[model samples]
Target: MNDHSTNKPIDESWVAHLRDLSTGVEPPTSANPHAMSRVAIRRTRTRRAVLTTGGGVLTVAAVAGAAFAIGSPTTSGPLLPGAPTSASADPSMSAEERRAREVEAAAVRALESGNVPAGWHVNVLEGLVYALPPEIVTSGPVQDEPGVTSDMWHSSEDPDSPPFLRMAYVTPDYEFYDTKASGLTQTPGPDARSFDLPGASVATVDDSAPLSEIAGAPEADPDRGLVKILVHREDGPGRYMITMNLGTADPEFVEGFLTTLTLS
Candidate 1:
């Protein structure tokens, strides 16, 4: 009987075969101490790719900025809506005075225009009247008069906006009316109607109460964009904003315009 547990005579030929296999396996020598060099190379390549992509993005942004600057209008001779086309138009004022007048005229192009400028653009001067107090609205620098108000064109310019040309007028107290807003007034005609500004208060409005006003809010939806329609009364004179609608006609360009507001 063959004994399974007891040690059998060793096969010297098989042992020789195993030793040959072991000899075929190469071991790391002093020449190549670090075993995992492939991983490091891959990491280096990834870092280089990321840096290259970042540089390309910055280059594109710079190019776009340059293009915008170049395409916009530029003139050193005279400002629009002020300087006449002919050299002999107004030879009385000095160049400095002419420049100052040009700037000032450009700043108030609408009132200076006396009529809305042509071809720039126009949004609806939709007629909407509302009640306000005399103490809550004013027009100089901020709040001057409220209630009997008219369309005020104080907004960021856009081609699709309403009433590109705007004018504001003060409405009188004691009665509500409806009509076209040629200028701010409470004289309501068949076309005009009152507006609703929810929960507006007197401290912020700064004008007298029970006053009437009119303004234009374009047809675009303000809530969708971060852009909002701003209408409020402030304490300052000559500059109170009655209403503002902000947005982009382009879906991609929609954004808010004003940076600050004050009631006093």
Candidate 2:
């Protein structure tokens, strides 16, 4: 994985290096009459200039604008003025959203009431496990590509808020293993089902950056566009997962939550 701290604009030279890596080409040699390497080098650099300044930078500008808007105090809560007085009166729910809410609520009740039916958790495989501490609940793979686990809790900072984590173990073969999501402009696939999830987005939940040239089985950084880790695969065997979506996106909190995961 590239350094998370790298702030460079990913210049033409870097892009050329990346391209050479992807296509299995060698750099130009003076003795070679054919300019194939030279041609490739030229084309990649030209494409870099055009793509970066013309479209990529502009798209980045728009996302920055949205981030600014979302950070404003007015957006912290409550609908904008003049939208409607009752706009605060319970927004309508999509069917999928309603179903998810019911499920989450049941989970909360089970945790609080201390009687989460065993059936609430599917026993996919024997080694899979979960545990809930005061701050978080976590469960994931006994091995790579473990099945998905989604769990949530009411937000501590805001009683009205609720957040959850969606955990999935990754093999080196998954596209999103170690990249930050570019942003959320890419449309969901054609068969995508919709839902109005109740709380914040947790950086990455099984996703990759918009144009990551990475192909199959890439490794990933847990903090790369990810609010919470899907799993700690590099922790090696017996790794499980926990996601913390119940509050503001804090990487520390997510790590703290991970500390509570247990194999039982």
Candidate 3:
């Protein structure tokens, strides 16, 4: 869990000290890492619905010569041209619009800091970074909330194929709590598990349905299973949820692909 190939371990104590110094108080120690509030559930549902319908305020950026690192060999190349320069500094934009722009820029920076396989198409959206096979197309940075964004991807030219992957980033708006009414409870069931990710205090994985399916349309394959990975920031208030809807994809491939994901 090194910071973006720095090979330097994150200083948790120093980070905590800084938080305390800035806030003049310590974060709550009793925050439950698992409880899901009604607001949170509703937020999640709204995000998925937007992804499913491919409807939202969309912004695209073209990242040329962006690089990223992964366990596999990688190559550097120009990506499709679409996105404009990050304009969070635009004086006319609302605070929410500025936040969304900043998140998208951070996502691009994350990709540029690493490398990817030669044939892969890198996706930078909503402060989440990952790569897809050449056959898949991705879209978004959909501003679900003031600070939350989502992206959806699926095979190209196949309108019938459901989006096999969706990713979202939620900026923490409240202090962490474990109570049933205000925080997240661990995703129930024996299949739920935890992961060790960089710069995260808690990372959990569990079964889920594709956001598209959750929105309404039934998946083409009833037997297909999707897995959701939730990662909570260690140094700040933010979290990322990545859904891999296992359709015709191999589970191992999905796991390996996730290794390339970068979040800010």
Assess the local accuracy of residue 138 in candidate 3 as a C-alpha lDDT between 0 and 100.
71
lDDT of 1 by residue, 105-183 (tens): 4434432433332223322111212222121222224343445344444333444543222234333331322333333
Best by TM-score: 3
Q: Cα lDDT of model 1 overall? A: 0.37
| Weakest lDDT window of 10 consecutive positions for candidate 3 | 59-68
lDDT of 1 at 49: 93
* Number of backbone-clashing residue pairs for each candidate, in the order shown: 57, 5, 18
TM-score of every model versus the real structure: 0.22, 0.23, 0.45
- What is model 2's C-alpha RMSD? 37.4
Tell me the tens digit of each residue's lDDT in model 3 across 1-264.
765674789899999998888887657678554565766888999999987666433321112222222222132343348844334223468988777767667656655666455567666554556677777777544546555567777768683565467676666542222222222332333556776566777777765433334434354654565566777777766667667655544666666566666655
| Candidate 1 ranges beyond 4 A from true positions | 1-5, 32-46, 51-264
Candidate 2 lDDT: 0.41
Candidate 2 vs candidate 3, lDDT winner: 3
